[model samples]
Target: MSMLNAMRQKSAKAERSCVAPGEAGCDPVSDEANGPRRDTESTGSGLLQAVLTRENLRQAWKRVKANKGAAGVDGLDIDQTARHLVTAWPTIRDQLLLGTYRPKPVRRVTIPKPDGGERELGIPTVTDRLIQQALLQVLQPILDPTFSEHSYGFRPGRRAHDAILAAQGYIQSGRRIVVDVDLEKFFDRVNHDILIDRLRKRIDDAGIIRLIRAYLNSGILRDGVVLERYQGTPQGGPLSPLLANVLLDEVDKVLEQHGHCFARYADDCNVYVRSRKAGERVMALLRKCYGKLRLKVNEAKSAVASVTGRKFLGYSFWFAKEGVKRRVANKPMATFKQRVRQLTRRSGGRSMAEVIERLKPYLLGWKAYFGLAQTPGVWRTLDEWLRHRLRAIQLKHWKRGSTIYRELANLGATEHVAKRVAGNSHCWWRNSNGDIKRVLTIAYFDKLGVPRLS
Candidate 1:
């Protein structure tokens, strides 16, 4: 009779752990690879009821569905899971409430870095992603209000532009010495102990804590082996960006307490000091603070320089003879030109119309991002350079001198100039800027729907 009574009480506890299926709440999972089940006090039944609901899971499903991405270790694509989520989520929810849900090992992927080498990322399953989104939805509201105003990372409604604006304000305020700092492998180096301890300080829900820990500690599935990660939030995980903000929030405090002018967008940090000596002192303080968090700064890449010397958010700031000015950073501008050159290669089999079609997406996107550039002269220069390339391609398509002459004549080029340009066999690049320039006017490209930067 006592044994029956104990079993009845256990069943009642499980029922109390979750709310009615029709209501909204959370769905959490644990890592099968973790050592033991050491958890904080379980969340009150009231919060669990609020976190774990069919409505909540469905909302998460809608969000994860919209942000379609590569499948996780399960090989289940977002599209493939939508049809089954209805039936599958209920069982998953039951497992979560029973403390038996185990998230699959994360799939390991390596993405090439722009400069060189590679960076690694771990992808979670579609189901896990949905659960993660649900977790993020609840956590963001509670913790976002507590973060530093200078932080403009993955938080809702904050963008890189805000950081840039703040940095510019600091420069204009006479904090011209910029300490360009970056964390070395920040995502992979985030200490789990530090992150979780901080989370506990803000949140007391043990179930939520366990769910996040599972996502962090889940082994990386690479080539059929489960490699355990002792620390660091895995990049590409939905919760990582927020977790990153949480881990780096202390950096903001360190700077603010010291009265240093600084702006941090994720791990890309810039501290502005009035003099070089102050910059040096600020760097020393930052290093000590990072040491406490176990995060390493990329000393090889970090520098203390003038505001004009460093690039922030793809724009370079310089003090012109008149006042401060902003322009596209040198490296990005060069890269944009390189991309245009590649796309407009005369050797490509694409025709003039096809080439314009191919270039539209890139050109339009570039113009949209850089349209706010303070220097209008750069756009005019880019416009001319691009037209020159297009004219060269059209001339190259004509191939022979006679063909070039006929095409140029058809393009409304004068007889004397057309003949002179066609006969110059030196190179199509040279001939392109000659009489052909008159024919391939800005209006001609405008008619062809070729997006012009200017």
Candidate 2:
């Protein structure tokens, strides 16, 4: 009887060892075709186990804290993370281990666009964000390798400048005809089935894939209602960027396989060819290819234009005497000017000193970002315009004609010039360009330590 019991126990152990991937404890192999899959460190347990490891969760928490986003529908924030996780984390982990984890609905909000419309955004719970971040760190190494070299949106060690330089190189080599492509409602229209299918082609980890699917179907909390999101990646999800890239990578490959010189930053892409005819052909190919993926191109904004006036990564290009030149595009330039105008508004009611302080940081930030432009004249011209704004601020501060004369003279403006300028009540803006320059000279701005774009 004892020998028979021992033999039965050994057989039971074998049955448990061969448990399927979906089960709690199973060692699944990496085969996306039909069987269970594995990530780098699958514990026979799969990506579910790999992602919930202590080290992975800790790293995820660190990133979640560092990013410091707003509260979701739960109203939990980074500051409350440690306290909330004291007991909640273990339960959460257990659910993940048991494959019972369900992401909370994302809080939906709308924000104004720069060009004058609103865009939808979804904010996930801080805890959900932590998990997503952790999962992303693991998947990034696996998926990023397969991405296109020409695509540079939100990837580690990649920037808009990288995309810009790639396009610059292409244009300099004489691919002047450009297909400036734009996607229509990209984030709101990502097809969940297609995204998951593309993902399976690269990663065989079924657990992580299910977690991602849960997120897509997690629903949106908006206006006190839960709306299901069957398709579309939420804009603010930590995992969304990487997921979007997975789909866009196909476009990049299509461009590459077709032998077109192109550069892409997120949804913005520019395909360059040697002639107008080639550009037209590339455009046709993109429309048809994008449709197959259930992606739509913004037909009105998508155009074939010369590299001379074409904009990519916020910089427009044209051939100068030496070679191709790039500068801040018109839209961004107008936006910058509008921002400066707002900061320097005479009716803003801030003192000249306060205005100077506010302008300092804005100017420094703008210069740091846009200073890469090869056009120094635009900067010099912006500097001149900025100083005019400063002078107008002082005039507005004086408010009264008598005070204006007194302040201008005190600031070293000649009495004759100050009197003549202050006498015209309606010429404050007019005088800012006139004799006010004599009062607030470049030397004066230099004394105040104002930032110069040039």
Candidate 3:
């Protein structure tokens, strides 16, 4: 049978299984063995208990509309989903509450990873997206307080900077021995059964549990082949980050219980200790905990060393004469330069202004994070390189001596000087810094809205 027909048959079987014996409606207890009730208060704290309300669904719909992506397996785009939800959300909400809603099979697409390999990303249908958002709205508040302050990944109002600051604080206080732990294929390796078992301890509603189970079991299509994914949550799915965070909360708890000072942003964990011996002991315990949790430590990436010898979350920590110092790690800084080159390259076929516009947000955000470190000299160097890149892009756009000369004259260069500069036998970089820099001053580009690091 074709994929579509197969999916339809599978969905029908699932729906049939959801109906309890001797009952006329869908059963929330169809898989009661997998779900168990817990003591949860039915007040403002019980968001999951009141999750299926129309207002909640509308809020979820709004989040879906704001997210950018293509249509999923159901082929419904954001606009189409929004229009349909306007008229059909009440019914959808009712179905979800009744535990009769079946999520569509996830549409899988392979995306290029940073290491030149491809990773599979599962895209959920618009309806599933709405459900995931609603679930997140309810679960976020309940889960947030339980997570450690060290966990900055995927949490609202927290960031890598927060993680770095915590680590820096430890180092400045004389605890310099650090163990950096990296998880191997973390999202792809989380066991669904373990995740659900842990989640059950905190959540009570059977309907929500059923929905999460269905979401996890949803089929994934990769290269026209249907695959049963019995493990990790889909990386691109809306709820994956939250679920991953939940799965690792135990690690945080275990470390805290053992009195290890650590900071974690998702899979990246750094444990601070008083000395090398203490660091080694902490690393051993961390490995033990990870092993018990069925998680693999990328031994090649994990390291137990001094704070000055390790990099965490793209920032390198070192002990300076003044105090602890943090800077953008060398590798990450190089990567940033490569990305800037890629964005500003003439071969991209974008106009100079367009390239600068595209580069602004990335540059601005990077600067904001790195600005925490004392790097005025580094910023000036980068600013110069960026200007040279912009000049090369403009030269590519001008394309000829006459166009270059005219543009130079337009930017306030004398006719003779403009002509002489345009006819020079220098390379793009040389020409840019030589005569072009005089005409298109830094202030000129500043007025034109190009971003600066200095």
Candidate 4:
């Protein structure tokens, strides 16, 4: 996974290459049709052949109009990765991609704990497994060679999931304290002026900042607009993550000054400390650093909890019962059916049953989150993709009894609420008589979309 983190740009070309005569064996038909023939122009020198291939080779080209995600940065190729390499480090680039090159030896260092503690930490070598797993799940569509660049993480969805899992793992180990720092708008809210200044502080390379500025100004947007100014790119731009990562690399200095006791990727950050006071001290230093950089923390959505159930990224972190759970509400009969149909279409004609099967893992977690007390089938249309592909059709009669029954039971008024409402009566919970009460109400709405409560 760490190797994946180091791999910033992905190549667009499919993994296709010529097979040798015996190793993978070339195609028999092609081999038989075009047998090797001596060329009078070819020389015996290997260097001569290399020069000829480099100069004479006419690379294959594809039409941008006929393909999806063709309008890449600068209209070179859909793959900007190769170009980025050539521009950034031409010598290293040529040796890596076009010629043979050996990687530098891994560097190591020793570190210490924050809070003026006595513990010393040794910096270990970066491993590939962490990045492999993270990017494998984050970029799952990459498994399909046909997938386009647009399918990449345009938002902080998968990254957030990874962060939550990392935090949850620590909590599950019986750690008594945990503090998660939430940077308010780490992307858009980031101060570019401060970032540029910080970048200069970290690396004396002005060219890198120039490159970053170019990326920021002319990047792509989902609404199909090219950035006309430094900050014109939409929040979902492809270069946003890359640029944000480079900027946050400066934050590592402050982290090291305070202590690099936690792990992070992009804006999804988790600061782990051994003790509660130590955690608070780290948070204080972080707050000071952000203040110095003209950044503020969003404390409302950001929380510090020893026992909380929240979904970080895709991993579920549960201390007690407050972990994050994915949810879907049942729509009206007419609208619900339409939604199921739409979901199926969006999932590439996946059948309803097959869709459900794919969603079972997430849906099962949702069921647990909802405190299943009534409905037997919680996520009825969870697998609409598979269901639609399979041509499975079923009309479900959704009962509103689930919420009413559960709320009443939870409020400890099952007997009282049942007594007040007659047979076939519908009710919702409300605060009445100095206690939770089930107020009779109808689930359906009139033309105004307002429910009638009685």
Residue clash pairs of candidate 3 = none
- The lDDT ranking, best first, is 2, 1, 3, 4
Residues 180-254, candidate 1: write the lDDT tens digits: 887899988988888988888888765567667777887889899999888888888788999988888888888
Q: Candidates 2 and 4: which is better by TM-score?
A: 2
Score each candidate by Cα lDDT.
Answer: 0.78, 0.79, 0.75, 0.36
The per-residue C-alpha lDDT of model 3 at residue 448 equals 79
Give the Cα-based TM-score of candidate 2 against the true structure: 0.85
lDDT of residue 286 for candidate 3: 86
59-152 per-residue lDDT for model 3 (tens digits): 7777777886778887889877666665565455445545556677788888854323467889998878877888898888888888886688
Q: How many collisions between residues are there in candidate 4?
A: 32
For each candidate in turn, give its C-alpha RMSD to the true structure in angstroms.
Answer: 6.6, 8.2, 6.4, 18.8
List runs of model 4 lying over 4 Å from the truth.
Answer: 1-165, 201-208, 218-238, 257-260, 274-277, 319-454
Error of 1 at 37 (Å): 7.5
Candidate structures ordered by TM-score, highest first: 1, 3, 2, 4
